[model samples]
Target: MYNNASVNKVFLMGYVAREPRIHNSKNGKPQLSFSLTTTESIKTQGGDIQHSEVHAIKINADAACLKDVNLKKGDMLYVQGRLQTHAFVDEQLIKRYKTEIVAIGVELFDPIQL
Candidate 1:
């Protein structure tokens, strides 16, 4: 093990916190927003347990990629993207910052069977 270059990339696997929000930008690019919950492995003398955290993500796709496929709420998806931080001023004129996963690729997983 060694401490080296700054590590900023992450590969995440989790369940969707909510339904995907599909929208179009003013320039007509297809975009979506959703949250994912990921679990971490917890270990101790007793055994192992999984801890989870919910993350917010944004997915941007080309118009052609969004055709015919109907994405709905509560859909299971896999997202590969980069970590991004957004800083903005709210209505109160106070500066605010938030971090989110900006997706470059999205894949839908099979639905959960009953």
Candidate 2:
């Protein structure tokens, strides 16, 4: 039995940390992956400090999103999607996991200057 009682959603507004890489999945579907960086300034006991966090984003647009917009490094964007985690084993027999936002929609803010 399943009930629609929960949701998995994420929203991020940050700058692109690197150029988007487009690839094809095993099923031959197009996929896009990129890194995004978000920064924030927090007031601490000592003073205000700035902190930056980087996130790995995976867009399943399958080339449709890139048809019109040109995305590049350092460009500001707003990403909306759901959070997904992938787990794997390392060479040393250690378990590792990574969480990424599976972008369903992306909006470009500041376009990169040529």
Candidate 3:
């Protein structure tokens, strides 16, 4: 990963693995955290089904749009932004690495218009 390039951006569209919640940073910045899950299913001609799943991504959204849209589990969301890595220490001082989407923007996913 290149640092200080300012070009490490990406967009994702998927379902939430869990509910979303809002919080404030110590410096008063707004943050919304949630998880994302991507899945794909296929049905064989013989009536058999197969599925694939992806681990959730922790996403943090800006506060400006937090109060505008309602984030719920299983809701289809369109997210646009950069990919970021967050680190933390767990219960017993175990180091954990998490990849999160630092959202630049988000919106409800509507397929009817597509």
Per residue, candidate 2 scores C-alpha lDDT tens digits across 1-114 of: 557688999889999999998888668777889999999999999999999999999886554655688888988999888999989999999999999988888988854532
TM-score of each: 0.66, 0.86, 0.67
lDDT tens per residue, model 1, 1-114: 467756566567667878777788557777777788877899989999888888888767553445565666566666677898989999999999989987766666775742
Residues 48-71 of candidate 3: C-alpha lDDT, one tens digit per residue: 565644434434455454557888
lDDT value, candidate 1, whole model: 0.74
Superposition TM-score, candidate 2 onto the true structure: 0.86
Q: Best-fitting candidate, measured by TM-score? A: 2
Residue 89 displacement (Å), model 1: 3.7
Query: How high a TM-score does candidate 3 get?
Result: 0.67
Task: Kindly report which residue stretches of model 3 are placed more than 4 angstroms away from their true locations once superposed.
Answer: 1-6, 41-67
For residue 65, what is the lDDT in candidate 1?
Answer: 42
* Candidates sorted on lDDT, descending: 2, 1, 3
